[model samples]
Target: MPPSESATRLPPGPDTAVTLGIDPETLETLTYLQREYGDMVGMTKPSGRLTYFINDPAEVRRILVRRHVRYQKGPGFERVKMLLGNGLIVSDGDAWRRSRTMIQPAFKVQNVHRLIGVMIGCSDRRAVAWAAAAERGDTVNITEETNEFALELILISIFGDDYENRFMKEGDNPFAFLSKDSTRDLSVVMKVRALRNLVLEIIEERRSRNEESLDFLSMYMRATDKNGEPFSDEELLDEVMTLVVAGFETSANTLNWVWYVISGHPDIEQSLIDEAGRWVPTVDAVTAENLTEMRYTQQVLEETLRLYPPVWLFTRRSIEEDELEQYDVPPGTDIYLSPYILHRSEHIWPNANDFDPDRFALVEGKPRKDRPYFPFSLGPRRCLGEYFSFLEMKVHLGLLLPRFRMQRVEDDDPGLELAINLRSKRDILLKPSVR
Candidate 1:
């Protein structure tokens, strides 16, 4: 790769050059960089922007955890900005700080615990649909099944009664395309922005009636900065959009792969079902205490995330001068981190290609103390919904896996689609039977 314009004492890299457009295109390029040069690889993007790929686990932590304040979100977020607007995912600096502070309370463990009922409700809905499919001896599109499960769960969690009274009453979910459509191009962005009117209307009615409820929408509406001012209508709309997209996609993709993995690993699937049987035998029994005891299920989810992190390749930019090892990172340098890469690196994970949940087994009531994993990124910018997503996945698997058994329609590999999110290139089909 060409020495970056600002390249000074940057790490050694080949001048063979690499083009980064996102996906395997980017993945392939980065992998080559790691193979040709050791952990920290630096190069100039074709756009003349200096870029550094940090696969060194310790350095990755330092950039993401210790000195995170010195860097802000970097390249490849332009399309994301169109979808999320100035919401938490796309905003930086004071805007991000204010939004995170205001929205953090809504994800408190106590708050997420209250949504257990909603998680079960959505999983039960999937059970109902799967039951009908099983009776008919029909092939189930588990990709669609998980997508609907997560989409419905997030909507109900956010809107509560409004999900039924408002969104359902209007016919199909206006945001359903998010699950069905994979491309995050202009068409999708336009569709996402158009929902602003629907969200804005909801906000307006809530303001008019002084509505209050135990749901994300209400919490977001009431969220105030240290100044004690609530989100403006536009800011509130962006937040709602961000919530829907955030809550829907990653979890859906995870549940999609969870089913695929379990289908392939019957032994692991049996363990998960047995764990669920012991811990969360029924909907009413899904207490936070019981779910916490479901460590094996958490392992399954973590392994799946390791294999296919949704937001696979992410970027950040340095805001101030920083040092990594002996190298100097000038301001405006772009940095890339990939959990997908790290999670599967042979040096980092033994037999990295294997699907093994045992690797994540809890030790003495905690995750193995030093496992280098960050499927949810790290530090303050770590996904707030980490707890919520895990519970949601565990609940889905706990309830559904016990009630139904699925066999992959064909034993062919469902290749990967590595775009903004890493997904199975083709919809995974399975024949289901009631357990």
Candidate 2:
């Protein structure tokens, strides 16, 4: 079969070379392409690699779920690989499969249930700090506050006792830089290397003691493959680093946006508070069951993710020929799917730019499959920490929102910063007052 005849022709795109990297300009270019060229626009990179911007819902689901095996993690991950090594986020093929299998057991709902106390504890710390800030009438930087809360929660979940006794005492937290610094320069790489070595040291110490514990590290240490093999030290280090980076960033960014969005919509904020009070009336009442009962909070989080998905852009490369809707995706073609673009597309979602949690409201005997929302993504490769992150966010919001009311310090919108993670360009400050 000849190259042109065997596959359907590519969709229409601009003749100008498009440089699709992790930057704001790339997002603007993508938005323009989608607007001008319709849903499935095709382009050639300056290097002559074929690229497709898939905004159609059916096609997006087909690429991510049904035909996932025909693709691999594509470009733009070279920078991520520097930080995460070949962990689950950047790893593909048998390596990803093997690592995912070993790590899946550790994230089971039962296992995650054990971490609720830790979530409450992290939220309580935030409450105490915010209470003091409210007393002093100071504006709270919700961005940095969410970052620290998520960082502390994940660290405790991953390290347990060592989070305090070992990791903290090393002066400043080596992992804290991952949250603060978004740039993936040489300096960031060096810091990642240092953090990796620190994690490796912890692994070695844990192995030496050979005692059983309940943290992620302990479970991962005990997890064995179908062949009864454990992850090598380097492999374990990469996986741990992946967990920390993946676990912390998404929840923190979403919560930061939640506060900003909630402040603008007082009616929605009161609904969340009422829902939280009904479910979790007191700190002692916080539990996995109670948190799950706060259905309105979940909807609010879902709507937030729909608007500000942390991973705004995702790229993959087709390793083999595939058919998506009417278009034929030729082998070696690069794929671009932007949740941020698709979520806000006026065609797919009516009034898509509006912040409406009711879009996710549950109706009796109604199904939600038709919605084109996948903030944590879909398919087997979907994030394993999705459940954990949701629990953490819910606990933080459900417990904290009831006691404190936050007013946006500034009326102007905090514009988006399109990077590897979608975040507010400036720190969002809010005035917290006791309710």
Candidate 3:
């Protein structure tokens, strides 16, 4: 299909502007624009540059799928670059293509399945702590709990034994700062610099050891470009930090939101418990094959992610002229496509605000899959840790939910914290008691 007759010309309107950041106010801004201008809305930035918010499913699909090569990661990623450098999540062009090819195999289902033991180990730590809290008749701070669980899991999955012997065994988790310090300011920047140095030391030690290992670190160390050259010390640091940041935050936010939702809806919590009991009856049964079989557990996680997708808003900039069903897009026009908004859009999802797990029940030729449900994003740039995250989340909730029940300490809704990820502004406090 080609451009429509009107697609040759830009849509006519006053370029109303809106600033969309990963913050609470941006949500209201996006909603207002959609209501006023429909799916495709034109706006001007403070710099007087024109940007478009495309809420149309087909148009969004075209930009991310068929015409992906004509765009790069835009807007908010500039701040991410300070953290990730030119890593796969931020890099584009042949640099991205090369890195994606070399690192793709490490995320294979079989390779990811190998990390299940690590996931179980991490969740066990949480179980120990939560059980202690339950015994004391104390409230479990699930917000911080999931953050530590996820950060520790990814660190171990990436660094293996080094996570304990090096980072955590020194009386405190060095990476704990990531959770406590939300600001991406100079202080946080310095901390990230220190982390990079630690990673470099580890990389050097691994290189000097001259032995084959199977963790993500070793896999990345062994990855090479088209010329059969490995990543330099600097390039390796970029990717390692990217993995640590990207892998941990998203999963943590999802787990935090899961606890919130589960606390509010006892019926769903009971269903999850039953499902967890049937699938993961014991620690030994919490294996990759078993996680896959927990279809109901998967649905619960899907529902949670649908309600609170971590990467809430995605931005792209066109590098070439393009046309959608009803409008023309000139080269260099910034585009905003949000799964957060679309998932909750009443037009796409009926009763969009409701938390109904039945909506995800698998059906023959289910049409929901065709809709925009991209928590891990879509197309080639989708998160590499997607499968790993789901497996880890399932293991965490499955192993724990059946053993302990959490009651919400407060009746008020835990509102959103719109940072790089959608997090709970306040810590979710739950009274943990044995089931």
In terms of TM-score, which candidate is strongest? 1
* Candidate 2 per-residue C-alpha lDDT over 240-322 given as tens digits, one digit per residue, 9 for 90 to 100: 98888889988999999999999999999999999998999998888888887878899899999999999999999999998
TM-score ranking from best candidate downward: 1, 2, 3
Q: How many residue pairs clash in each candidate?
A: 2, 0, 0
TM-score versus the correct structure, for each prediction: 0.98, 0.97, 0.96
Error of 3 at 349 (Å): 0.2
Clashing pairs for predicted structure model 1, backbone only: 1-14, 1-15
- Candidate 2: worst-modelled 10 consecutive residues by lDDT: 1-10
Question: Cα RMSD (Å) per model?
Answer: 1.3, 2.0, 2.8
The lDDT ranking, best first, is 2, 1, 3
Candidate 3 overall lDDT versus native: 0.85
In the range 170-270, model 1's lDDT, one tens digit per residue, is 79888788888889998887888788888888878888989689899999988899999999888988888889888888999998998999999989989
Lowest lDDT block of 10, candidate 1: 1-10
Best by lDDT: 2
Q: In candidate 1, which residue ranges exceed 4 Å CA deviation?
A: 4-7
Model 2, backbone clash pairs (residues 3+ apart or across chains), number: 0
Better by lDDT, candidate 3 or 2: 2
